[model samples]
Target chain A: MIPTIPQPRLLTAAYTAYVVTFFVFLALPLVVVAVFAFNDSQFPSLPWEGFTWGWFFGEERPVIGVFHERPILRAIGTSAFVAVCVSILSVGVGLSNAFLFNRYRFPGQGILYVFMLLPLVIPGIVLGISILVFSSRIANGAWDIAEWDIEALRPGLTLVILGQFSFIATISTLVIAARLQKFDRSLEEAALNLGASRLTAVRTVTLPYLAPAMIGAFVVAFLMSFENFNTTLMLVGSDAPLTIAMFDRLKEGSTPLLNAVSLLLMLGSSLLALVMIAFQRRG
Target chain B: MKAEARIGLILLLTPLLLWLSLLIVIPHIDMFLVSLRERVGVGEYRISPANYLTFLTEPLYLRTFARTAIMAMLATLITLLIAFPVSYYIAKMARGRTRSALFLLCLVPFWVSELVRTFGWMILLRETGLISTLLQWAGLADQPVEMLYNDAAIMVGLVYTSMLFMVVPLVTTLESLPDEVIEAGYDLGGTNVSVMREIVIPHATPGIVSGCIVVFMLSLGNYLTPTMLGGKDSLWFTELIYSQFIVRFNWELGAAFGFLLLLLSSLIVWGMLRLTGHTLERTMG
Candidate 1:
């Protein structure tokens, strides 16, 4: 079949060139990152002093591979922990939110819907700092009033989860809600008509329909949490997430180790992203 | 509503309220309050506009804020201009597997952290980096040219970071436009430019607006791209906010800067929506 909006020959050639350039721009940095990960050098940039997997598996001094690096490994663990926590919390809250928006009508629903979207528009740094400031105030106020030492209220993994959940829940809600809207209400109705309780009907009928979207949202939430920087940066305590950890190391200087970790991150996230796309297609 | 239904409604509303008030609403209000207060001394505070006043009066802060706003706008505009054709090529020109592959390619780079992306740019643009090395090898320059730590480098990084965001929205919008409409335009004896300007752009307005808004917000609030690529002298407004909060231990000043950024971003996004004759809801959809 002919393509839509057929162009003149010169225009077609120009568009082809433009598309090629765009993809090259997109792929170049990632290729460079992956390539230098194996470089047998201290620096990430290259005159390509031959290839080796030293950055990924080395044990020599100053050539510590990512697996051999304690702090980097700890940072990755911290990031995974935070992502898991954020994903579970976001999806749980998102389910309630989708149910609220789709299954019920309430006063000020329109305004509340708009407010739900505010987090999406607000800058991540803004959300992070605001949460940081507000929680610190509460923590300090508790100390002044009751001598309560709620250390969890301070900047830490807890705050990171909360800050990430603030926006990511919105995304999950949108995803699940999109799926929920397309659901045939009559299936639940039929289950209810067959002497099933409301909860039973929902559990058996509705939840099954939403399974793919929920899984998709979970993967997406995990990816966003793991890759988040600005928000995580503000909320991090001593237990820094991967992004913060990488950022601190970057400020110090670039290392092939950083490239190695990045290559790993790229691989991990791409797999998760592919899972999300597959679920989206299936759903 | 019945009592049980009312209870269920309240149950659903609980999470939404807690999320909005405890997380989004109250924190923002606290931020505003903190912005208006200045710490006079230890365990002492005074309500004042002095923090904001400092921002306006300080030449460095004011200049950085202006530079950041201008740069973010330019980045947004550039992202739109660049993404439009690529998105069009994917949504209209490419078929089946090619379309999906192009779309997936757009997403692959973003899977990594922004730090990694910045690191990649650093490797490409740094003094001892590949491009400079290439230049020297080609005898195009006598020195290893420093490509990093400048506004242009910062712009490149910003544009790169935002391209995927713009492309996603534009592609979504463009995909929904029927091919028949464009064919009809051609049948009406319209040139490519005329059809594009009159038909294609009008159809993609929502996408363009949403993409611009997201890109502008991202570029404005971006921290890592500017700092990593443009170095310490980047003078990006977000970095100022960051320094005030983290380095200077001056939360009051940082809070003020944060509010100013929030306000400015809101105002700009609102203005864009109004100019484009779209609402946040409509464009977002």
Candidate 2:
């Protein structure tokens, strides 16, 4: 109800304080990560040593404080590569699935849609284990069928990408499907009536309309793939994704270099998001 | 359909179908199969009900499941309690740029990974961390307060991660409420609290239900927050499952635990749908 008086000043103040504190709680860790990235100390703790950019651009230490390492860079590259592959595959598969489901109603459409969401509902660890078992079985069965020695199929970047795509595609499909719901079918009809082929009509009308959502879907998919841990952890081979690498480091014994990596990733993602937003606005 | 359209549909449906069949359907079937099997060794699979028996017979496993459910419920409730007023404020009172800015602030955390966010909480709640230091500095305690690596930490992590889900839907639903209904309540001499209870709350019920369901499912299925924050002795159901399959190489027990979690979440989702009178497909999608 619109009270005769505006929100009581005391109430507003209290609420404001609560919200401010909540945001502080939310933001503090990120701030700590950023701040400690420059600390000269090797550990992620308070009483920062001096502000130094050595972690980002520094010489290596032989024994312990080797902040600038090639492995970290290689892990980052692997993560990017995997994320890119997952993004493209998921987007492609998701967009097509969305198109198929939206444009045509099949006999088992409802069942199919539910099946698409099954990956989302399942526990990540279970999904990972199942995939691992299934892949191993396939590799074994193939070896038996060929009656020849075959290298054991191990979990690696390829399997990780596949594992990620299993669910990321589902998310992308949902996003694109939501966008497709409001799409005006008459535009396609009009294009078709104007002597354009169905494919041409879709290319001109449907694709343009779904472009923004598809882009958003791609970004979400990429982020999910890149930051994924549970499934990646289970499926990761000798070479690890950045998230797994960070997790392993944390579990063993973490250093401020972990904080440095976190800050770098945060900055990279934020910049990417900003660029996408700017591009969308400009377009 | 045209030949090209037929071809396109085939191309689109094939990979998704293959993915679902291989990754989802087959694995679930495998899980079910494994659930009925006997555990032999670290990574051996066989057919038996020994693992299921372990879960069914053991008080520890049952207690873990019960504890997980109770913890998830508490976290969902806490998240709702914390998120509702803030959502209402943003939806009803905040204006223009302030509203947008606050909303954006709510989403800013989404830029970071959930793992990182949980790690952030771990940092703050650790015995020697900020919270303990602050409490000591404020003279509330002689020694640093011990907070981390417990059920409370697990709840905090869950709530922190799921807060946005509760807030966003609540804000959207509350914002969409007709001003006229609120005005009508006021014209009838209703107080702010009365109007909120009668008008605002009822309108926001769908959102609240959906939000609760989302939070509950997420919390129930959550493995990371509980494992990381709850520490070794937490022994959450998912962690138990992980230990069985990954550590002990007991696939049957792990499968049984996985099925229990799945069944519980599915039942909750189903019950929520029935209670809210919303279709599961619509709500979840």
Candidate 3:
């Protein structure tokens, strides 16, 4: 665009080549996954056999694909449920914390804020293990107090949600708090001046102002919980998300069925991106 | 800070404070103590530093830790190298819808799960993968070649996984530089190398520091990427930490290793910030 700015011809050629190579590096692997999904070979790897839709549509007895796989479907269902619960819990907690920090301050609020965001700073693996240890200690103490014989306490779905929420809620709080920083309080004040209760003012004025951010935060929590593997893997006993399930399949060696799963995941995420982009354009 | 607001603050903050303390603060404290203990008998433990000592004494653990740290740093460096040009293009050259589209390109891949992304690499690079198939078709090879499970594979996975973290920050900082600065440098007879060294790199310091810090931490703490791409032979430190907890059920040793990782990563990131003459507040952004 700036003709006189003068990029040398050699440098220009090099830059163009670099750009193309980088794009190929970023994109080609993902494309390969989709292309190989339809290969008739049982393995996801190679030797291009003729295309078949069996990977996407097959019978239960055949066990050739993900379709009609109850275990995987149940895992999907569990993940959705956990993600929903995490979204609601995180948004509620995050909103309340954001309100506290933004509107009202108490002693040690600074320390409290740091502690809340620690989950984001610390490794997810560490967070998962810490929660597991803490819960087990509490459960063990309680069980001992009751003097009742029981199985040693181990992590469950509840602990998984708690582990994820330990950090994700903090992320929600940070996002909402950033939104809150710019939000004017005069609308709430005006409502209060007009003889409305504080609760009424918040419900009528503040909540509406915060609704978009709340939705954004909820989506963040849901996605993070849904895709979270490191933390959830430690806490999940018999249950698994798509990530954990996929990891299991990978460890035992993979097949084209898993490739079908990868294809579906790719399609699902692309759809999510398009929808978000469309939503942003509308806004 | 007002007495009249105390009741409201208490009411709003109690649940949050209780939850954080119970979940985060207490667990970290528990981990600290657990990391210091020795299991002497069944259902009995005492304060000892054997776990930490073991990490120091074991050559396998020590070598893995050193390798993991070196590889993480190397990955961070490569990511920075790859990201700088692309970030510069998006921030300075591209405009309007084109710029937005390019920026979106870097982001869209991240939304897919990391597991899926790593699987994508395996599909292309494994012995019977796309690459091998292509080579065989071209008569370059007699059979499929194994491309996965090596140092190069791990590096590829690491760089691919963390490149976005590097680019986004670099773009953010570079976009703020006025075009006139570069124009001024050129008018003063600055060549490309001189201009890049004296102006562009200096201008991009905060972004560079932040991006490197982030990429390093993410790569160092990663468990899934290395295990998936590097196969069984990969001795990533996180896998060591993971094996302690999940495989051996050794919480004491795992907690020690976990703390060591946290300590090492934080120390390295902080030292980097100091070396680059950036404050924690500025670089953490």
Listed for every candidate in order, the interface RMSD values in angstroms are 1.8, 2.3, 2.4
Question: For residues B220-275, what per-residue lDDT tens digits would candidate 1 score against the true structure?
Answer: 99988988888666789989989899999899999999999999999999999999
Candidate 3 Cα misplacement greater than 4 A, ranges: A1-4, A60-63, A105-107, A148-153, A281-283, B1-4, B277-285
Q: How accurate is candidate 3 locally (lDDT)?
A: 0.83
For model 3, what is the error of residue B32's alpha carbon versus the real structure, in angstroms, after optimal superposition? 1.5
Decreasing DockQ order of the candidates: 1, 3, 2
Q: lDDT by residue for model 2 over A1-283, one digit each (tens)? A: 3433366788778877887887886688778767777778766665557887777777766213224587888888899999999989888888888888888766888989888877766667667777766776677778779965434355788789888888888998998888888898999999999999978998999999888878887887888888887778777888888888777777775567777788877887787677666655653
Weakest 10 consecutive residues, lDDT, candidate 1 chain A? Answer: A1-10
Number of the predicted model whose DockQ against the real structure is largest: 1
Ranking of models by lDDT: 1, 3, 2
Per-residue lDDT over A1-283 for candidate 3, one digit per residue giving the tens place of the 0 to 100 score: 1234877788877876887788788888778878777888778766677898888887754435677677777877888888899999999998888889888755777676666656656778888888888777878887889965344346778888888888888878877787788888888889999999988988988888877778778877887888888788778877777888889988998877887887887787678667655644553
**Pairs that collide, model 1:** none
- As a TM-score, model 3 comes out at 0.94
| Candidates, DockQ | 0.69, 0.50, 0.55
Higher TM-score: candidate 1 or 3? 1
lDDT per residue as tens, model 2, B1-285: 687666877887898788899878897777777678774686565777787777878998989999999999999999999998889878876888999888878876777777777777766788866778788889999997879889889988999988888999899999999677888888888887898899999999888987988888778877778877896667788788778877887666777788788888878877887987987576667
Clashing pairs in 2: B36-B48, B37-B48
